[model samples]
Target: MQPDPRTNLNNELAQLLNNRIVEPDYKREITITFRVSSAEKTRLEQRCSGVVQSDYIRARLFDYPLPHPKLVIPEVNRQAIYELKKIGNNLNQQTRAINEAVKIGSQPLSSNVKEYLQTIKELAVLLEQTHASLSQPISDEE
Candidate 1:
């Protein structure tokens, strides 16, 4: 007599929020695994009195219109200037870092560099695949 994992998790979350506890409806155990960052785990444990796991995700769905603050940025020549300034600032930071590393005689192409390049290449390939998949006309199965 084992409860489904989904049912057990839902019940546990309900109990936690209600400041109560309940054993799983079924006596048998089930194992479920997922990943969570340590910071998120700590935050949940601090806020909740009962079991919390990676499977639980909080979502906010708006079925009704909710008033939100509007940010109006008037488009003008200054807007483009600000964007270019931000980009220039970021590029400057990268340039400084690279120059400093070179001054220290760090290896131009270390294993870490190769691994990073490989990761970028893989990401580009993934992007191309994703683009191709999206470009193909989707057929609905009857």
Candidate 2:
């Protein structure tokens, strides 16, 4: 028996980590149709990896290059990123409140401003490290 189309699609998609051309094409007005199981369609969407569905289909069908498939993000890293963003937002709010206070002369501008800036820099470095670590799973290393 012939191999399943889904399996073949997966195999073909494994090599899709190259960049596509940047020119516009007018011949893409033609349409193609095919049937896929619901689960297979989900798989296709997953493999599309943030690209437009039609673009993904055309690349697959025409044997063109595509970006690295952005599959599942790491669970731990995802949570950490969320928590860090929350903390950053809260910090920013507090800093803005302090700035407003200083602007209104209700509070004196302290030398600790330098210290707060240093803390923000540290937080930025930490977030960047986390971002790089989280990106490791989905980023194309090839």
Candidate 3:
């Protein structure tokens, strides 16, 4: 009696993840094979972007460029951050001058300016709390 086609396919679908120990170039040669349930294989197929599974495995096992798209981390905009810091410094200096003039009775401190100063003080409290929280190690018991 011959094996049914679906049964043969089920056999093909079984995972073959066992490995033989060998010298490391991460591979004995540039071939890798694995089998799994059809659903898992379908999901894995998406990751390889239609490249032959063994070849995709080889590309990943060694450090070769992938035929498929790779993950990209966004770069930090250092120049923009530096400009922001400069603007913040300028605002701080202006705020200090306004406070100094008000203290010496040379400037009339309006309600809006007082509200801005209150907001700045609250932001400073929040900044201090954030800094202290970050400065502590995560494993400490206190």
lDDT of 2 by residue, 1-142 (tens): 9989999887777655343334547677778788999999999988887787887876776565765554567788788878877877876777788778889989787779757856876886787787677766655564
List candidate 1 segments past 4 Å from native.
1-107, 140-142
Tell me the whole-model lDDT of each prediction, alpha carbons only.
0.52, 0.74, 0.63
Evaluation by lDDT, superior candidate among 2 and 3:
2
**lDDT per residue (tens digit) for residues 22-75 in model 3:** 233653555545669999888878878646766576576654556744432223
RMSD of 3: 16.4
Q: Best to worst by lDDT, what's the order? A: 2, 3, 1
Clash pairs, candidate 2, are none
RMSD of each: 20.9, 12.4, 16.4
Candidate closest to the true structure, highest lDDT? 2
lDDT of 1 at 125: 62
Question: TM-scores of the models, in the given order?
Answer: 0.25, 0.52, 0.32
